[model samples]
Target: MRNMILAVIGLLLLGCSGGQSSNSTMTVSGVAATGAAVSGTIFLKDSAGHELSMATTDGTFSFDVSALKPPFMLKASWGGKTMYSFAAAAGTANITPLTQMIVAAAASSTDLDAAYQAPSPTTFSTIAANLPAATANLRNSLKPLLASYGADMDPISGKFSANGSGMDGLLDHVAVTSVSGTVSITDRSSGATLFSATASPALANSVSAMNWANDSAAVAQDPDLKVSEAGDGLAVWWSYTGTGYGASVIQARWLNSEQSATQISTATGFAMMPKVAIDGNGNAVVVWMQSDNQLNNVWVNRYVAGSGWGSPKKLTSAVSSATGPSGVPSIAIDAAGNAVIMWNQSDAAVSSHFDVYTSQYSVANNAWSTPAMLSTGTNSAYGYKVVANNSGTAAVIYNQFQRTDGRGGNGDASDIWVATGTTAGGFATRTKVSSSANPIYGQGSLAIDPAGDILAAWIQNNNSGYFDVWASRQPAGGSWEAPKTVANSVTGECYSPEVALDAHGNAFATWEQQLDTEGRQYVAASHYSAASGVWDAPAEISENIGNTYDQHIAVDPSGNATLVWYQIESAAVTVRSAQYLQSSGWGISQLIATMGAAYDGYTVFPVPRVAVNSSGKSIIIWGTGSM
Candidate 1:
């Protein structure tokens, strides 16, 4: 009888402890995505590198962890790359590029994947203690992008779907990529660099440098940035405030090679507005306007593939007759390494009258031809651009004034004109491109494809109180099509139109339109199909959050277009960019950078530019100042 009583006592004791064991076991589940869903194998690991559970997931994963760990790690191994996540007390942990970045930051070892595969005890403890701080840094770094979503949206612990909404939507616009020990965060839609840091144990501290985007940095104004791609390499040029005569100097950064920003201009003068073009053999030529004590002239610098930048050469020597400034230079290189550079030189005989001049560079001889006038009329031929096709055929476009009275003044009317030829020969065979009687306010944009097809866009006064965006096309060996109003706002005014042409002659145009004098300016866009030969209806690409200005656009060979602009929101200003995929219509506008709030009544203006390579990779750059 006594033995039976003891057995009953033992059974009751076991029942009392059952609830405790069940409470210790935690079930963790989440979705893995890389913009879209990630189909792979998910593994739940402890700090000691032991896999507690494994599950095959088609984006959604579940794992019942028995031995609960404080710093639990989740990894999803896909085909190309693997993503990782972290959980303090397991409930939900989504494996994604963002989480992978956090994991890399928290890990002690430089090799992220290797460290996660088999973490030592000391490294594991380091990760456990550093995870919280690393996560806080990430949140602060992406504060501008997370403003629309909840600022406290936890990428690791928050529950989310892979359907591209809320947190998932934010992920779609950002690109978190890791190479070796370096992690880079960029706007996925525009390829604008947001933040980058080394994935070391000190990443938690270094990530704070990204605050420079919000809080102003010592970086100079008017980054007049330009970029070009040669094969898999990229060359970027910009002018920044340096201690010199004009307080600015030109700098170049080489990407996918020895990554560094080198000053390409001498300290004797100030260099500004540098344009770069790279050939197929990875060589590049950068052209810019330099101002000396005497006059403003055009300068050129050559960069060899394996070699570095060569000596700077002055391309423009003032003629005895025309001694004024020579500026607004444009450059293009053909397949054979020959280059054409065009600029506007002020005619000394007539004040304020500028003429277009051209200079050709022969690669075999490594010499530049003497500058020669290319414009025909006596009026100012400003805002000229030159583009080259693969076959060495080059085209130049500019805005020239025409007055019925044969005089230059407020009564003069302007029209767009084009000239076609080669770098070997001068740009001859000039033709009129626009038939508008209205005056042109600014220079028109020009774009050309590999087949010598051309597209141009400009803002023309609609004879009303506002301006309209007009575009024209020239088929290969065909005449210029009639100018059409691509974007006309009956209620608002439009200005600053920019156009881009893809490899197949499809075109994209973007501009800023103000709904009313009291309303904020909005960014608008239109698309033209080469096959249908029809311009699509204008679409508002901006979110109408603030007044927009300094808009720019570029299109890749795959027909993907990226548009960038400055948006003034409340007291702060933001640099925003949007992507138009050939497959999908348009992605949401992404905030690339932002500035702190400024004093009331003070306005800030930032100019944005974009360039794309043949493989759909794009680089966006902009100028930032006090907001």
Candidate 2:
């Protein structure tokens, strides 16, 4: 069976403004049928049909139209479809009501508004006619197998079942061994167990069995445990280590609830901090950092929709002495599949100081662009984070220590700096985003909204009693907003702050706070409202599962947030996740995976990273120590 990955792209606009005003101004707000905050292109045209002002990714496009004539039109579009056109007069506050626009499937070419107004029968018939031929082709191809397995086939429902003989025939085609009274299958890379009932020859299985079975008996199959439409047809990139040595390997898999996973590639000598970005054509590009001997290098690989996996290409060949067994790397891929990867590098020239470096991966030519230096000031630049939007615009944020009086002992002062440019090329100038005379020093995380705006959060301790979480944002086409305190650590220290921004400009942030009384780390979070331009009160995302560190947060396009962290207790660490419920608050934190008796002296934990698609589906990937 051939496996294919699907990618969908939708345009979005983000609005950023300065301080609030008391003067009366027009406020436009609406929601789509999918509950996505309605945001897109808004154009103001004059009486003569001349475009006066236009809004792109940034929400508000203002002009000196207050002196212009009256009787203008406010035209808007959302989700790549026109929503409504309103007539308005100058200086009048106008708010367009929420408009419902019909959405068509992938194959439909007719205009959405026209199709909605047409007869119901015509629309249905048109949809049926445009349905892909793959559905029918697949059903017909599996019919013969159904008969041979004595399975009953239902064409309408696309279900197949076998009672006795059918099940026997299906099992005969695949290799299944009994292990400790359980049926198990072993493959070259992994192993899986089949249900006792399914292993029996009396029940006929469906076509899913054949599609998911490994091509060779040496390859293990993945168990299809959960079946949900929410995460169906989703592709996630992750890394896992098998019994191998010499080089680290990271792999990408395209998964669908109804089909087998498609493996992209297994690149070696790379750390498992894998990052992936998909294009509209279902093509994906993955990037990771590989440490060879004592030298660290970054690499990129591509997976086309039809092709399985392409060869891996080296993005950077810089040799350095910073050969540590464990170093975290960060990467981001744009809509064009151009990847911007950043990592800390220690060289002989800058002893004891690690600098952040970045390189770009170009998908058009299947090669990495020239490596560019993102950080310039001093040698104490670290904890680099990067984000890129669909337009190939990228922003990289990091902490830089100003070389003070040629004396360096813990670097009394630090500052956060940001560099932005089109991924096309030429990143020569970097702007300092954080204005801290006596800045705090720690690792930070960054997120880019659809409009290419940026949000950065980190932990800083400027001789204060305890470290606190600080956040700043660069609104669309505007400089970074003043840094504000997101959470205060009165007793203990707050560290490892991470932030993620949704399509609606809503920012979700998470961090680890150490309580002085118990010396336990608790996970906390806060939400920033775009409508009110203020952060909601800080809320605890994790509970009971105390004594944790290295927390990461992810926000979906619909403003849903998920936070994952590692909890250490009794000298062992466990992974846990807490999901946010906008309707009823946060759900109870649940433990995801645990390290058992095989715990080594080193920490056995998962360093979580997450991404969300336009459909609000999310994928999280993390690494764990050997058990």
Give the Cα lDDT of each candidate.
0.69, 0.51
List CA RMSD, all candidates. Answer: 13.8, 20.6
**Cα lDDT tens digits for candidate 2, 458-486:** 77764556778888888888887888888
**In candidate 1, how many Å is residue 534 off?**
1.1
> Which ranges of candidate 1 are over 4 A from the true structure?
1-220, 224-245, 256-259, 404-411, 463-465, 597-604, 625-627
Q: Which ten residues in a row have the lowest lDDT in candidate 2?
A: 1-10
lDDT, candidate 1, 1-627, per-residue tens:
011111000111111334433244456677777666666678777776668645453577776654645567777887867777876555667777777777777774446667667756666677768888878766644554565444346777666544455676776776777654546677665465565545664442121112223322224244443334432334344445645467676777653233346778776677777887777676788898888665789999988878879988887864444458887689988867789999988766675687788899888888998888887746677778898875788888888877533235454678888888887776878888787677666558888888889888887777675778888898998998999989766778788787888888898988888888567788999999999998999999999788788888877776877788888787567777777766557766777776545412234455566666665545555554435
lDDT of 2 at 302: 71
Q: Give the TM-scores of the predictions, in the order they appear.
A: 0.68, 0.60
lDDT of 2: 0.51
